[model samples]
Target chain A: MTTVEKIKPLVLIVDDNSTNIDLLVNTLKKDYRLGVAKNGQKALDYTEKHLPDLILLDIMMPGMNGYEVCGRLKTATRTKDIPVIFITAMTETAHKTRAFEAGALDYITKPFHTAEVKARVKTHLSLKKAREHEIYIASKIQKTLLLGQPPRDINGIQIAQLTIPSQKVDGDFYDFFKINNQCFDLVVGDVMGKGIPAALLGAAIKSHFLRVLNELIRLTDKKEFPDPEKIISSVHSSMIDQLEDIETFVTLCYARFDMAKYLLSFVDCGHMRTIHFHADSNRCSLLRGVNMPLGFPEQEPFKQTLVSFQPGDLFVFYSDGLTEAKNQDGVLYGEKRLVDFVQKNAIMESKELINIIRKDVVAFSQSDIFDDDLTCVLVGIEKKSTSQALSDKAKLEIKNDLTELARVRDFVRNFCEGIPGFPLDNNRINLIELAVTEVTANIIKHAYGEHTGERIQINALLLDDKIVLQFYDWGKAFDPKSVPLPVFDGSQSGGFGLHIISHTVDEVVYSRDKKGRNCASLEIKL
Target chain B: MKLSTEKIGEVTVVTVLTEVLDASNAEEFKTATAPILKESNKVVFEISQIKFMDSSGCGTLLSFLRQLKSSNGNLKLCRVQEPVRILFELVRIDRIIEIFDTKEEAIKSFKMGI
Candidate 1:
């Protein structure tokens, strides 16, 4: 038996004559699985229930003749592709033409040759098998290409992603890698098209990112870190050269965060905006104005923008799949909606933030079928230390010197910069400076008697979105709690200094430093 | 966007165009001309009397060439004025999208398409 026969093609034979059915059955049963129908109606019923690879029809069938049966079978989409061969007594060319027109693949005279029947059936069946096999392999490859590994935890950033392919595969991808002890990089991108071609291109681009990251790390370790702009520029050129198809381009965002410096630098290659939230101020901002997508050889040097982070601040990076996700009404879950969601849920913990956004996207789209891959990376800056609060009298000695005040301001700025969700706006900066001035001046006038020989030390620490500023000084002890709650008459100026500091900040506490000197500490949401 | 093109030969096609070439209208132009660029290597964009070319307009053209190059196809520009040329030059886009002198020369070079 040939390879085609080994697969056991099923053939349905319809003939009114018992002798003819037996003859055809005997001829085909050895090579194919056979189903016999005595009439055209029976043949149609059998074909509808069990779709066979081919059909052999006897032209002289009783009710519903072979020509009518063939025409009906040929008209139905499900049965049309099944090759039919006519076995009839009529040998006229016009009769053969009518058979062919009715979608018969071949015609055999009443005295049929077993070999001819076998050859034609074998040829058509094998061709069908090959076509099906090609489609199967193509779909399998597309599936394998899309089943990317989920992001593993790197540093404090929590990443969870879901990808749903609209067709056989998708081209969107997101990856996370720890570049060093103090830094981690997040990458999210989408290739231009869909299916196996775009999947392959996406895989290529992802592999390139890995290779470039490795090289970047090696260079940085060797004190030869190439400029990020140059690295991306070369990658753009190389990708353009390699994937020379206009239907395939990559819109990517590459971000590297240094925990030690509390700084994040990112290069946006014509992607959706990365939303950043200042937890302290309860406000949000977008990182916009990026260059064109990668693989455009003519693209200019792309620059990376740096943003400072304080504890409790959040950075959200996502693909267009999320923003462009459309609801059943065809309205997109646009950038504004995304930003609003992020702002409302920014206070949530990192894992909760991811879950909240994921749920929101599902609700907004109002469907389980996500048209594109949805991926989001949430980075939350955690507080580094917990320090003791100081008393009011100690704050006086700590504020005795100009050098000490400057040192305290520098420390406050640095601390604020490190925390996430803490606004480093000019208003907050000025408030910090003014609060320090008023508190120190009150400490000198009320506790230290303007003594130049005294020394004061103040420390400010970030706790989530709040900044705890502590003042310590070597002076007579004082308690701000006992100090009259300065009544705000709305027009009172001089006495409102302490009141201003209290209301300006989120909270204040009074306690003693380690040396028993009086200290006053205030906590402000930056 | 409307596409009115005059084929210089079997190789090159010169597009004489007018429409809002911004992001809002670029999709139509991109869809209409993308297939033509894929079939041939040489495409000369004649932008001498064009009115406006925003970032999105320029981006559409760049994306076209980028798509062409991905398929081992090439696209070139010709007959652009100093004003429009300055936009490309400003971004140093000349390095990416090649500019030619005339449509005839661009078509002639594709005698053996890439």
Candidate 2:
């Protein structure tokens, strides 16, 4: 077999003097792929097209000095991570400090020694390689830990979540557990440090969640859900030593949603404050408790607080990457802005709400790249209405006046009650009523321009375990896409109508009937 | 909409006496109640009779909240009906304003300066 050739790491050399260039090149050429640039500008131009594994730059050069070149390289995303070593004839300590301040990884003094050059270059190159390997491993571990999928087909809760693993330091995780038909649990965790170590710890914490939970299940009654505090306490005890060794901690928020009891009990451990959207008051509040992040030995025991929620309530659990995101002005996106955004868009479906929130955060920061892991989870409380039986169909008619809204609700209530064995609860019926009222209001306000003497038709397609409501109006045809996602301009206008309708119903489809009437159909799965 | 008012401590507990607080009477209720509660900084809206409410009605409450806030005063609610209460929650207006389960609690909150 023919001998295989090793691919040497590429190195770029920049020097104004050809003699010095020749000296350095002869020393490095034997072990590296060498690229030569006579001036700083030439070196920058070379780096623009080709990325070298290492850069040896001369500080004293005319036309774009090496300090300027190294600064530019460190500022650029593509070249920022490339290791840059400076070469200079000056023996002053100030020059060396300036070189470092300009982001030079290391510097070589004047009058080059071939042995010293070889040793420094070899050591720096190996250090760069080791760092790259660590990042690669860290990212791989983060990806593996993020393999969980949010549970599906929950009766009364809508969950939307996002996770973006970072290149440098990343350790963000979220998981959902189905405790029973009437209850569920959600936990979000983030390791405080960056890079490979933090990522590994995050993975470890995620692995421990199941072990701690299962042990509680085994030791206690199987019929009951594990307590949030007990599970977190056990996880902390097991992971504290490892965390202390690493000098880092994990922020965790564990919440249990009990649908039957209408309670959300949670234990917050040094995580970002969880946002609570109260459906009854049209308000948002930050939820936090007195507990240190995991690994704090002096911390009080984690305590769970219980808060009641009605249908249409919402919650947002996020990592620091979201709230701590910085704009060009260095202003943090901040918790207040997030609360406002959530309050404005509270009527939206959870998936749409979270995706828009992510987009908003990126837009506010003016960049998509994050130095830390970005993660967020949204939860919306909904009505789990059960009907005793199904009906084939139903129909109703109403005037353009807003007074007709009450009549519309009555019609829906009667329709659901008329069905045998229909699961009609206060929460479920409330949602259908709200959706119907919202659409009718939109028709009167936007389509009819709030004029009187207008009439509309309502038809209900009561299928198996679902209801589809259709509304027909002779008013102007409307483009649903024209409406922007909800933002509070302090007005009742904008997309609140569409948001509420979409949030309440499983599906909303708008079409023009054969009779040229505007038809909007909304479906709710039982 | 019909209106009834009572004074418990420094708080004026106003109750809407009608079942419907919709577009038909939202503007009227806002206009009539704003003057009577103008002299007091602490106001409690005990609206249990409002079994049905629309967005305009909710807007009326918010406008009053802003008005009270402008003067360094405050407003609260008590005994809101379920349907109307859920309506406020969906729009998140309850966060801007405080709601109490009882009128006495509302008055007590004003006394406690909460």
Candidate 3:
């Protein structure tokens, strides 16, 4: 009548001998709650109804022997861990071995001593408790280790990552952190192998990255930034030294970006490709450079490449897991599929892009569990609108009037006012004004002198760090490249205007419009 | 950032102090440490400070160490940081280079030198 929690460990006794069952019940009742069954079938029924921590079976019971009952109990996962001990009159070693082989934890004699019965039961239960405790601790450790929170959004870039391990943990890790107002560093890597060993190595790599980044931050704060190449190389060496004992390595890609400069530099350590999408041109370029994977015994030099990115451009970096994911029919998802998915989902925000890829990969594999860990990061450069370029009222339309020089001067002043932190030196400012005047005068004197009906449009785009001045005119096409090198013979007056325009700007590009008109574009880096 | 040293038979084991060295100032460090190279052809650089290093720094260290090798003495590195250690592995610097993690171990390595 004791409560379930207070009741002693339950012992089930199955025997055909009424006297033996009664004796066992009386002997163990002080230390345990005892259940009796006359046959193996009844014993199984009793076990299914009221689970016991231990079982004592009589081998020679009629209609289903102890061996069959023990086998059935062990096969059922719910009752499998319950300790079974056989009671037999057979004194042969082989018979005892058979009883032990039949999933019994121990064997007791037919006329068991009360103390002997209690000792065997207590020993097996303690061992079982210890095993269960070990399993519980292992599960707790695994849960704590595998738990990961998604990356937070900074500026317009949103990052989310998943590392679905084939075992308790995976070897993939990623990091996204800001270096400055216009610079951010991103890294992702996969250690060779999987599971606990690789995961531990992965954690080591993560720690190294954090340490290096902290050093970088300190150096930056101190205004004595170290060369990024050296930092990465040192990180590689440290990782190699740490992982040397494991006979494994890591493949990493490190990239740093300057949003203000619109430049990105990256180094690849035998990682997969990094994709660059030019939003304005709708073109995609893949960066494929190789260095030895970390931990190799050779010192492969790391190379850093710089790329210019405009607003609305996208940079996508991913681990091979995405391209290597296999479909149900054993067809790999492949690089082409990944590229296509990105292209189709390019307009989506970074978070949405990741979800789309994840959904597609899951649907393609036809399984919720991925064969390999999946990780993807997309960095989107938000485009500034034309209104943000410069004020509409500040825009000037060049007219055919002969006395519009004052209007042009007013336009320059307003244009400069519209741009924040304009760093125009006196010489450059004068040069720009002279170039504008010469170009406009040339169009007026040569192309539109007699034709007042023709209209010319000039637009100025104020970018994140530079200003682009574009001149569009319905005038006849003229190729500047075809323009003869003007012989500037010590300040010749008329012909040097075009020469001045070419030298005064950073870059000048000319293209013919579809209507056979002329368009001249100039870029000035700030 | 950790500093520890060991001595073996007039050879001084100096542990390196930094995680990564690059083109920015690696050449200067090489220049400053040249006196140690001159003092003993049998110098063991315990490179525990460097976690990462680039090719320029690696090249500088290799060229200096190789100079020591030509004098029938040797320059050794020990306890290489992992990332910088990777550069040595990629270039197979370990094959020709003697590296150890402990000063006692690296000093012991010098006993069999040519």
The model with the greatest lDDT is 2
Two-chain DockQ for model 3: 0.01
Q: What does DockQ give for each predicted structure?
A: 0.01, 0.11, 0.01
TM-score of each: 0.41, 0.56, 0.43
Determine the C-alpha RMSD for candidate 3 after optimal superposition of all C-alphas.
Answer: 20.7
Model 2 C-alpha lDDT per residue in residues A1-526, reported as the tens digit of each score: 0111247888899999999989998999999889999998899989978888889999989999999999988866457788898988888999999999999889998787999988988898889877877777887787777435777855567889877655575678788888865678898888887787788788788889889988899999888767898888898898888888888888889899877567889999889999999877889999997788998877678799888887788999999988988776668899999999999999998999998998998899877766667889998876333322334578999988877888888888777554433345667787787788888888877888857898989997777677788999999888898888764433442345676677777899999877779999988886
TM-score-superior candidate, 2 or 3: 2
lDDT, ranked from best to worst: 2, 3, 1
The candidate scoring highest on DockQ is 2
Candidate 3 or 1, higher TM-score: 3
Query: Candidate 3 local accuracy as lDDT?
Result: 0.68
Off by over 4 Å in 1: A1-162, A217-227, A245-247, A383-526, B1-114
Per-residue lDDT for A1-526 in model 3, tens only? Answer: 1243365778898899988888888888887878898998899999988878789999987789998999888765356678899998987899888887889989998667888987898898777666555444433433444233433533334454444443223467777656644467787777777666666677677778778867776767565444556667878877766667778888888887765466788878888898887877787788766677788878767777778887677878877877887765568888888877777677776677778788898888776556556767778766554226334223457765434544554566456444433345434554555455546655655556678766666777676667777776777666666666643221221344466566657777778768877777767776
Please write out the lDDT profile of model 1 over residues A406-425, one tens digit for every residue: 44555555555444333465
Task: Kindly indicate the candidate among 1 and 2 with the higher TM-score.
Answer: 2
For candidate 1, the docking band is incorrect
**Whole-model lDDT, candidate 2?**
0.81
Which segments of model 2 are wrong by more than 4 Å?
Answer: A1-10, A14-51, A62-65, A68-79, A113-123, A278-283, A327-331, A344-347, A364-367, A382-526, B1-114
